[model samples]
Target: MNIKNTTSIFVDCHVFDSGFQGTRTYIQGLYSELIIKRDLHFFLVSSNPDNLASIFGNHSNVTYLKYKYENKYLRLLIDIPQIIKKHKIDFAHFQYTVSPFKRCRYIVTTHDILFINFPEYFSFFSKIINTFLYKQSAKWSEIRLTVSEFSKQKIHQHFGFSNYEITPNAIDNVFFEDYDKVLIKNEVAQKFSLKKYIIYVSRWEPRKNHQMVLKAFLDLELYKEYELLFLGNDTLSNPQYNEIFSQVDSEIKKKIFTLKNTDFNTMLLLLRGADASVYPSMAEGFGIPPLESVAAKIPTICSDKTAMSDFSFFEDYYFDPHNQIDFNDKLQKILKENLGTDFKIMAQKIKEKYSWKKSVEIVYRLIKQNQ
Candidate 1:
């Protein structure tokens, strides 16, 4: 490795606090691979530098910088540029659609343009903020990257930038760590009162299409055979919560579970032990949990919409997200299928397609090419 062309790469790690699953995984996976490269230096910027350090450990090539302010605008506009210049960064990776300053040469990862396609899901203020920042970020970025072909097309259609790259999201190989099913099942049963369960891993938000998923699961009578686990934080503020719960029978409600802030290891155990995984999201830049489930060797059923179609097993596995009948049918197929062994084979193939090692190499080459 030639040290002559080594560049200082600044990564906006603030997405760590956003609690958005896809963005968090995208950054962590890439960073984990990048940190091992001897030819580059990293400056990780986050609100919680200690926590970031704790996750990545003390890499000699990595430096962690804490952003003290809680206000996103102030931190991005003033603090971020100052930090970049202070460290004399050659390039930076903004993990999301926007970067605070345009003075430095940097790459921006625009996860998706969901706001443009699904305006009803976003507030007016959020739409405004994202619209402005997304356009500016697209214009300024040296290389724009997205998580899927669906997201890349969305960005091109909405932002009119055609030169972007598709850097698909991938699971941490940690999910593939082997576990003893009998012991893990016994432990999970005691901890979460587990039953024969199908897992749905995503935030409890409307865009995740939780209502449709719950309806489809109940309509198919799948709840009688298997518990429906909704993994993520409570969405008490979401109106759909009351509407969906109101329809649930008191007895059936016991079979529906929601676990928020679950530890990663425990979540992996849950996935491993699950009978199957269900993801009927309305839209996505790229769906991670479905792929994660497949990687965990848990049979998965996903919506046919958006980036879920990109999954290698999707042709046989996807259903119409908006149609409860189609969802119920897909759920039934997943319940009856004994394709776990085949999916495990597909999982290994899928794993090859989405290595963080490959993704970081693209980023490194992009940085080098631009220089």
Candidate 2:
């Protein structure tokens, strides 16, 4: 350690340029707090250094570095290791996988090992490769972390990684800000030409259960009054969603919209304008969208599967992702029954329970101990 009493750390920031996703959210939320501490020096590296700088403003303890190679292996093996040595980093934190050749004390947060538990959702090869890389990364790390108790348990059971702490995702305070919903909706309707709508914010993947959400929207005939908006980038092929859309009438099809890779501010505007939010993902490390919806004070119906079950505040709104009937009943009730009063009650609980400040502090403490 240096005489200055500061612990230098390197953070892999490649995920920031990959658009809005869970991992990006985790890193941005965690470090936005960690970088404020004068005792900790953070070297954040990415291909897009400008975007990193814009997100995280200047601080005395913070530094932004850029990646040389676009290739994953080269960046991991050559670029990062060299940076660690040059900067004299005391510790390095990686999202899921760490550099194979360690240059400093490594801290890895394998957000989840979902493939090990829900083998059907992931491909055979993906499962094999990720299991190997993630397991090895955990094994090499001096301290390990994950997003939820469910994820922590899965890691231990599958990879025998016992030295891990859960640093869960929390709803950002921006979502809870008091904004006039009618005005936001009116602006959204004018700008995007969107009418009364329900929202589902997740990438298009079979495991994310997009098809089921589409089916429920169609079956319930809610489109007559509300447009169904699927907001996210497509990652995997969902043949079922295609098949369902093909059979539906043109008017019914017109009522459903898919907005891809919109900026974060637009996402928030759309979320605020939503009549309701539906998150029916089959599995998750820690479900952020549902919590975000609750924070936005919108009536949300979420799946009670995997880590999402921890969001027990959505009790009446919870449904089985695999069961269409259960989802239908809950969805029907959430929309028909005005839940404004209920939202206030749920919002208080959500705010009180989870916080990015709390989550990030725990992670920082763990890293400082190991550093």
Candidate 3:
């Protein structure tokens, strides 16, 4: 249980950037907590050298190791093992499904088992790589970490690994602040030039089910008065998505604005001010947007499927992700009711269960238990 005696723990991931995704935020939060406690020495192994000092900076006990690989396959074959021995790492934590080396004790964090259940979203090469890596990582990992119990079940059902532990993701404390909702709303409305808007905060991926969201929004007879803000990565990066984007009607296109590359603070402000947050993803390990929205005291509607439904706060708020009619009904209800009493109570409940400090404590315990 004495973590201070451990020489070093290396975090292996594609990038350490804060804006990358939910996993990066989880790692950064835990890293920050560990630094303050001075209980563990941490090292981040990332692909980008530019991010090394900037993202991690000069922490007395933490170091950044630049890990370059021609490809993930090459990294598994060459670099990962070399770094483990070179740094004398006591334990290695692979943020993604794969670990490059097996010489030392390792822990692998499975964000989701989406690839195993839905392979069509990924290319043939990606599917093969993910299947191989995830299975191997699950089998080899001394301790496995997952974001939710739902994800743990999926991993066991598909990949047949059952030794993993759960560590739910958390919202930053800044998100739970008492900001003037009316003022924030006014700022967002003026900035985006809108009367009212629905919000979707997620990556523009097929699994995210954004097309369905757009279709549901269009289905709404009331949509003429309100717009839907699609905030995240630009769908233009992918050719298929780009083609879909180009063919949209001009009127719909005007209402639909995709603001790519916004900072974290701005994102929180937008979420706080939105009329309602809609996330109808087909799959997820731990959906953070709904959690964040609830923390910000905003009404949120998420798919009833996946771990998102497991939260007590979402019991009355969830809608079926697959059914357009269900989403349409929920959207109408949100617009009509607009932060109902039930919604306010749920938001309060979410703040109690999902906090950054609580989540960090879970990570701290997991590290100590395995150490």
Q: Which one wins on TM-score?
A: 2
Give all TM-scores, in the order shown: 0.93, 0.97, 0.86
In angstroms, the error of model 1 at 135 is 0.9
Q: Which stretches of candidate 1 lie over 4 Å from their true place?
A: 1-6, 18-20, 234-237
Q: Which regions in candidate 2 have their CA more than 4 angstroms from the true location? A: 1-5
lDDT of 3 at 148: 88
lDDT of 3: 0.74
Given candidate 1, what's the lDDT at residue 352?
81
Steric clash pairs (candidate 2): none
Kindly indicate the candidate among 2 and 3 with the higher lDDT: 2
For residues 49-166, could you state the per-residue lDDT of candidate 3 as single tens digits? 5566575567777777776774766776677788878877877877765555577888788888777777766677877877787888778888788888898998889888877778
- If both were scored by TM-score, which would come out higher, candidate 1 or candidate 2? 2
TM-score of 1: 0.93
lDDT by residue for model 2 over 271-322, one digit each (tens)?
A: 9999889999998998888888888998999999999989888888899999
Global lDDT of each model?
0.81, 0.88, 0.74
Candidate 1, run of 10 with poorest lDDT: 233-242
